[model samples]
Target: MIQELNDEQLERYGRHILLDEIGYEGQLLLAQKRVAIIGLGGLGSPVALYLASAGIGQLTLIDFDQVDLSNLQRQLIHNQQRVGQNKAISAQQSVELLNKNVKTETITTKLTDDELLKITKQHDLVLDCSDNFETRYQLNRICHKCQIPLVSGAAIRWEGQVTTYDFRKNKQPCYQCLFPLKSNQGSIQESCSQNGVIAPLLGIIGSIQALEAIKCLLELPTLAGKLTIIDGLTMELRQFNITQDLSCPVCS
Candidate 1:
C-alpha cells in the first residue's frame, strides 16, 4: 500500500519534484523503495549517504568490520569519533542524521547463504560495496536467485569499476560473467590496505553506484551488462560490454 507524503516530505523533496523526470509520482515511488548496501566501507559510504538523502524508504546496511583510524581517509560515513565502532552501526547513525525518513537495518555479522537470501527477498535492490571476491560472489548468487538488481563497485589504487546485474531482466550478465573464477585459488586480493587508494576515487565510483541504483529502483535505463571503468591517475573513462556467458554459473 502507498502512503501519502506528509507536508515535510513534500517540502524536503521539492527539488526532486521540480524535475520533470521525477515529478510527484516518482518521488512517491522512491519513498516506497527499499535498498540494501552490502558494505559500509569506501564504496558504500557515498552510496548510503546519497540514497538516504534521496529518501529511500528503507536501507539495510551490512558490514562486519569496524571503523578504524585508517578508514577515515576514504570512508566518509564514519568519522574520527567512530573509529572503533562497527561500520554498519556507524553508517546507520550517519544516515539517521542525514535523513530521518529512511528506516535503516544494521547488520554487523557476516551472513550465510540462507541469511542473505532471506534478507535479499525483503529488499528491492542490493548494492555491492564489499572488498573481497567471496562476498561479491555470495551477493551475486543470492541476487540472481531472488531476481533482483545488483549494483556493484570496486575501488583500489586510483582505479575503479562499477556495473549493474539486473537479474530481473532476462539474458543479462551476472557478476561472475564479467570475472570468471579462473584459478584454483580465488581472485587475487588486491585490497586498498595492500595498495593505497586516493581519497576521492571511492566517491566517484560509489556515486555512480548510487546513481545506477536509483535508476534501477525507478525502472529507468541502467548499466546492466555494461562495466564502467574509471582511472583517476589518467582521468580516463571507458565502458565495455558484458555479454551473458553461455556457461555463466549463476545467470545462465
Candidate 2:
C-alpha cells in the first residue's frame, strides 16, 4: 500500500507527481522503494544523486575505494574536500544533502559474491555501476537468482552503454547472457582510468541508469531486453535487442 505523502514530500516531488505517468501514486511507490547502487564512481555518482533526489526511501551504497583528485573529473558526488574518504560514505553524505528523507547506508568494504547476494536480496532494485566485468557478471548471476531487476551502465572513453535485466520476467536476457562470462575470460578489460573518458559521457550514461531504475521501481515499461549504446563523439544513439542465451548458465 502507498503511504500518504507529507507536505514536504508533496512539495519536494511536486514535479514528479504532476506527470501522468508518475502521479502521486508513483511518487509514493518511489518513496517506499529500496535501491542498492553497487559503485560510487563516475556512473554511480549521478545514479545515486538522481535516485536520492527522487525520494527512494532507502539507498544502499557499496564501494571500497576512496575519493581521489582524479575522480573529480567525472564523479560529481564527491568534491576535493572529500578526497581520501570512502566513496560509499561520501556518496551517502551527498545523498543525505540531496534528500534527508531518503535513508542512506554505506558498505565501505568490497563484498564477496555471497555477501553481495545477501545484501542485494534486501533491496527492490540493484544498479550495477561497478567498473569491472567480474563484478557485473557476479551481480547478474545474483540478481537473476533473486529475481530482482538490475540496471547496468558503463562509460569509457567517448562511448557508453546502458541496459536493464528484469530477472522477474522469465526469458529475459541478463548481463551474462549478453556478454557470456567465458567469452570475457583472459580478455583485457579497459577502464576509464586506462583509456580516459569524457566527463559528460558519464553524466549521460549514469542519468540513463537512474531513469531505468526509477521506471523499474514504478512498475513502468523498461528496457529490460535491450541495450542502448551512445557514441559521444558523433552524438549517435542506437539500441539493439538482447536475446537470452538458451544454454547459458546464469538466467536460462
Compute each candidate's TM-score over C-alphas.
0.97, 0.97
In order, candidate lDDTs are 0.92, 0.92
Distance (Å) between predicted and true CA of 6, model 1?
Answer: 1.3
Residue pairs whose backbone atoms clash in candidate 1 = none
| 199: Cα error in model 1, Å | 1.2
**Deviation of model 1 at 77, angstroms:** 0.6
Instruction: Put down candidate 2 lDDT per residue, 37-122, tens digits, no spaces.
Output: 99999999999999999988999999999999999999999999999999999999998988989988899998898998899889
Q: Which stretches of candidate 2 lie over 4 Å from their true place?
A: 186-188
lDDT of 1 by residue, 1-252 (tens): 348888999999999999887888888899999899999999999999999998899999999999999999999999999989999999999999999999999999999999999999999999999998888889999999999999999988989999999999889898888888775144467678888999899999999999999889888898988999999999999999999999988888
Give the CA lDDT, 0 to 100, for residue 20 in model 2.
97
**Which stretches of candidate 1 lie above 4 Å from their native place?**
183-186
